[model samples]
Target: MCSGIRTNLHFPTCWDGKNLDSPDHQSHIAYPTAGPATFDTDGGACPSTHPVKIPQLMFEVVWDTTQFNDKNLWPEDGSQPFVFSMGDTTGYGQHGDYVFGWQGTALQTAMDNACFGATCKGLTTQTTATANKCSVPKTVNENEDGWITKLPGTEA
Candidate 1:
């Protein structure tokens, strides 16, 4: 009920599903249409040729205004990027170095209790990293800034 600022993210409509990531990265997937915009997720297949229909991945990132304001975070200059990205070749095409580190409680509780939507309510903070099959170094990205100094809850 206390969600503040927010943003919406929509993944590519078509997916190859074979590569977790690609080198050139552009050739492995495709979008069959072009327009000002029309995201057709009407339970349709990818294409007649390569049939892989992925359930649309929609991400709505809800942020707390108290901590996420432009001044507290980063202000808009004429050319300063409000955000920095390491991956995604097709996006801003900003291929460069990025800092990777944990910012909050232990990596264990984050791995075990991470959820998408309504399930994330009434959560507790943990203070240690528990390394197991569920808690690997590479799995940390799934945590998605879990170290931030705020709890995760968005208006549904």
Candidate 2:
């Protein structure tokens, strides 16, 4: 149960108020401050004129990997599975960043239920009462598909 699988989420901080995205797709906006500290309740602003400030989002979820390493669960790519990914090159940074967003009210409730969801049985035992509150994310990592990208000749 000590196996470590961590998800580090980084979001954007500043917007120029005009561009839907930047030239590099990353630079048009900026981080008011470096890293996750931008999310701090006590943190400052991104120069009043920027118009839209998407207070950075920072969070990490670490799941135990006792099962991820199991030999019986090899992934479909015929490659070592990926537990998480950032700025996947194939997508060219499309999946890498976020700017201004908040975890909506339903998100917390949904996460709680997903993490601690009880086994659903016949109608005798189901999550009907709280179904609305507990969202089933469009994508869930039901499989141990952990991918680690490294330059050639580099050990993962």
Candidate 3:
């Protein structure tokens, strides 16, 4: 044998703005009467509904070959040293420096590796020329395939 009880649930009727005299007139409003109340009783502007303007960042790169070479001149250390400089300016300031050390087969190999995917290569040579008289050449290939070009004549 089994026993069951029946219960009744009632949902109040909704009221539109025109039906102010209706029993469920409060339901005409969009919000529920028992739900959390909004700070804007009269429906003030929503804090998150306003449009916000974002700032745009501007940047430019200025290169002074003279300044770059002057700062990156590596002093003689018995072996020839190769020098290279790169700059990237995007909202950030200019950045330049030298990557140099040693010479011969090792130096060549290092330069080859450094300029693997680069558009230009650092100077490579066997002679340990003085900083003032040194001719730093740029390479088009990492494997020393094409002719290596010297930087435009500039005061060391």
Q: Rate the local accuracy (lDDT) of all candidates.
A: 0.42, 0.50, 0.32
Best by lDDT: 2
Residue 123 in candidate 3 has what lDDT?
A: 48
lDDT of model 2 at position 108: 50
Q: Write the per-residue lDDT of candidate 3 for residues 1-156, one digit (tens) a residue.
A: 112122222222222335434365333323223322223331232123222211111122222333223323433563322223222222223332223335556655544555322333564434323433655687564564322234335434
Model 1: lDDT equals 0.42
What is the per-residue lDDT of model 1 for residues 1-156, given as tens digits with 9 covering 90 to 100? 223644455454555767645697545554544411134433344654334544344544445544443453443553322232432324344323223354564334444565332344335433323322243357444655423433235233
- How far residue 2's Cα lies from its native spot in candidate 2, in Å, is 2.2
Instruction: Evaluate residue 44 in candidate 2 and report its C-alpha lDDT on the 0 to 100 scale.
Output: 47
The TM-score obtained by model 1 is 0.31
lDDT of 1 at 80: 23
Better of 1 and 2 by TM-score: 2
Ranked by TM-score, the better of candidates 2 and 3 is 2
Error of 3 at 136 (Å): 32
Model 3: CA > 4 A from native: 1-51, 66-72, 75-156
For all predicted structures, in order, the TM-scores are 0.31, 0.38, 0.13
> Per-residue lDDT tens digits of candidate 2, residues 50-108?
54665345554556666667655655655545433452433233334444343555445
